[model samples]
Target: MTTTLPHFEPFSPDALAHRGGALAEGPVALGSAGYTILNFELATTVLRDSRFQNAALKLMEDFGITDGPVHEFRAHSLLMAEGRRHLRLRTPLARFMGPATVENIRGILREIIQDLAAALDPSAPVDFHGGIDQRLPARVYCYLAGAPVEDAAKVARLSERTLSLLNRDPSLTPVIVAAYDELFAYLRDLVARKRAQGLGEDMLSFLIAQHDAGKLSEEELFNEAAAMLEASSVNTTHQTGLVVWTLLRDREVWQRLVEDPALIPAAMVEVLRLYPRPGVVSRIATEDVELNGTVIPAGSDVHVAVWSANRDPARFENPAEFVLERERNQPLTFSTGSHNCLGQGLAKVEMEEVVRYLVEHFPNTVVVEEGTDIGQAGGRWLVKSLTVDLKP
Candidate 1:
């Protein structure tokens, strides 16, 4: 049986969220190359089912991308692993990324965000995306990753180049490959520098200690560091910008947040539900299985339209509207099941603090000129360069 998948503008995240659910109404719809599951309930079932495993590692290998920072970052990261391999590394890393650890750093994060927010020029429009969003996450995570905070700008630049590789765009492969080489060298140097000093309390130090204890290999430690750099910085950066964009775009939303600070948390949840930076989470079927009356064959890739599922009317009331006090507002922004994002705790801490500070400090903040980078595939839903007037 053949299924005709409707054409979706792959570049626009908003369009995908608004149109994907309708286009993929059935249990599962065929995407450009694989099956696309847009139903919220079915996507949850697929996420938890062991038959559907993460395929990012296999996809990268299939692309003939051998070794480098990209390989270290994506091919061996927890997001790409399954079963025992995933557990082996994730167990230790999870401890470091838990709520307690995240809470411990809130004070530091607040200081960083507050300082950045203070630097925003009220007299003229400031490039909020580049000036604050891009820098804050990198600075915070670099400190956590045990890399010198001074090198955050460099790490961010390198990560941006290598991030294109994840989009799986053939035209950008060469540039992405070159970026991997540069990033690999930088990570290697950074790792070496960290090693020269004794283990500290930072995340990278903890991973290095694990390596020394024979739990992870030297290569694994470096790869972990590289992966942490990308995840901690890129995703959080875009999300922070998008959340602010959502708030300021709607005067009522922004005013509400300002008037009632308690609503900030719910506002954050709604923003994430409304606009997940990583629009889709995909998996591959390890064996043929029947789900919601649809037969998914073995070896078939399943693209879970996270953006669509979050806004599915079945799960969310008035899916298009952003309800600050939304009940049971569970969005798959951090994914679901065993492969759920490990850095989600950190992201929440970073976001809540940043948003709170922005709203409180810049009460009259308004978008001046805004644009998005929608060309890339994964983790590319950025407001890109948002010029905002931070005046009162």
Candidate 2:
């Protein structure tokens, strides 16, 4: 079905860029056809408020986007859930994903980074996403989910295909669908095996035990596994690119890291603050609410533009500059509040480890061509397609 709503002003990235990156001061209206969109909040507020929904399904319907391999998988992740249902599932996730717990996992994650970076051939042009960056979180996610490290590359391929739903052609749905089924089935069987072994220490094993103990349903286990795999794989890879991009363009950031290797982790935080991969997490307003003096009526779609919010002058000094030492940059990168990413802690650990290795090993790495800006079809800025020459 087409959009069922009122008319409002149009908002597009092209238009905004053409106007020197400034848009109207309030929530810019986006019409699906001729609809008033809804009483919306800035993307950042929408991300934090419980009233809003991801409305991904609603968006697909309005845009006449039919089922495809990638879109189908996206429908299963926690990133798309709203309200009580989201909370119900996310609570346990928070248990293992807390900051302190993640901090403890750094030793193992560091080992992975050291091993992987040691394997890179700096003389050759490597596809950073598929080769280096993807490996950063692929092993971590596999270990967390109780999957075999031997299968990380295979799983990464499935993830790449699934995430392609964001910008891939609708015609590729069949291929991705087939890959997803195989991937999901393999995970389900892995969970079963872990259960048969009488419990596991990893997250997937824990999920399996929960399923058997009635804490989680069968459907929940499968979907959640897919969700975990994809979220862990794609977002991390994209953020790795963000770090590289930031470092390549700014010699000072690189010099700062080289001078103080201990600061790589903090530099990574700055990267997250500047260029987060996952698109703005949005919510559908369930009720009318006032944000910064604007009353958004119920059922509005709110989005907290991660990039914009992170750069808001009110929040950070010199918002546009990349400050690895910024002590007050409370980036909305991992978001805040109840639904904040359950895997953020683990993701950060992986990032820190990878960044450390990259700094220590490739101190003078430079992007030869500076690569192309692989712009996202779905407004994800971090999913850039760029190739560069790496050298000392």
Candidate 3:
């Protein structure tokens, strides 16, 4: 018997709200983008299963980026690697993103946050997204890559334009192609400069060292650096903005964090659950797989609706409401299993520090609703603008 999955358009305008309603229909759905996993349990299962591979390469192919530097990069990048190859590429980068390393960067995060925040006027509502969130992650990336601090803006722009491919808009192919070319050129020059200055302790220098030690081929070395740089900032930028937008509007929760800063981590997790930046994690089914009594054929595109899974009633109590005290509050915002986000720990610590800074410095800050614009598209939540009255 063939089980007919319900039709779902994950990229719909009201996708965030619609995903919750779709869960009631079933765990799996047929959509234009492909099959969507709607429940937390199944989403986790699919994310952990190696049968489904990252669809990024396929997605690029679909967008007419079949043969080019962009195509070659996607084909060889860590995102497409598997098993031993994946671990090999991931290990060197993992050291810098691990819990201890991320924790040690807290003081540095604080200083960066303070520096970004210092530029804002306390007496007026400011565009928090642009002035702070948009810039912090790139600066952090610059530090990690041992690049000049002055290059932060270009790094942010390249990261944004390159990763904008996730928007799934074919029209942006030209822009995307151009961005990757520029990114490759920028990274190549940066690597050359690092070599001239001699190796250092920064992440890029470490990758260079790995290449010199023969652990990573010269090509693999550039690929690893390019992959890391491309993914470093954009998502973190929006996610940080979302955290502030959600917490500021929820005055009661805002007060709790303000009163007890220890709760910021939990609060951050809750915000991630409610408004995950990467709402959809797309995968390609390499072979026929039966999921929840439905057979997904080979070469099928499987999108794990992270936002929906995080709010699945079967998994989370009071799926709609934000509850800070929920036990086992892990969200798929950073994904799961082997291919999970490498920078999650660092990103979380960055957000927590930002929250902590706000709580200590501007506990009375409130969202200026009129100037704030938050929206969802292509199953991703984005912050267009976030205005906050720091002293209000």
Best by lDDT: 3
173, model 2: CA deviation in Å? 4.2
For residue 356, give model 3's deviation from the true position in Å: 0.7
What's the lDDT for residue 65 in model 2? 48
lDDT of 3 by residue, 202-301 (tens): 9999999999999999989999999999998999999999999999989999999999999999999999998999999999999999998899999999
Q: lDDT per residue, candidate 2, 1-392, as tens digits?
A: 22222233223343112111113443344444221211122445555666665665555444344566445655755677666777777766777677766887788887887777666677875555555677767887777777789988877777777666554256765565676677777776787777677676888877777777887777777778777776667777887777776776687887888888788778888878767665455556678776544566677665444555566555577767777779875677787776677777777777666667667777777664555464544435654564555564
* Top TM-score model: 3
Writing each residue's lDDT as its tens digit, candidate 1 over 91-124 gives 8889988889989999999888877777777787
Q: Give the TM-score of each candidate.
A: 0.91, 0.82, 0.98
Error of 2 at 99 (Å): 2.9
Ranking of all candidate structures by their TM-score, best first:
3, 1, 2
| Cα RMSD to the true fold for all candidates | 2.7, 4.7, 1.0
Residue 148 CA displacement from its true place in model 3, Å:
0.4
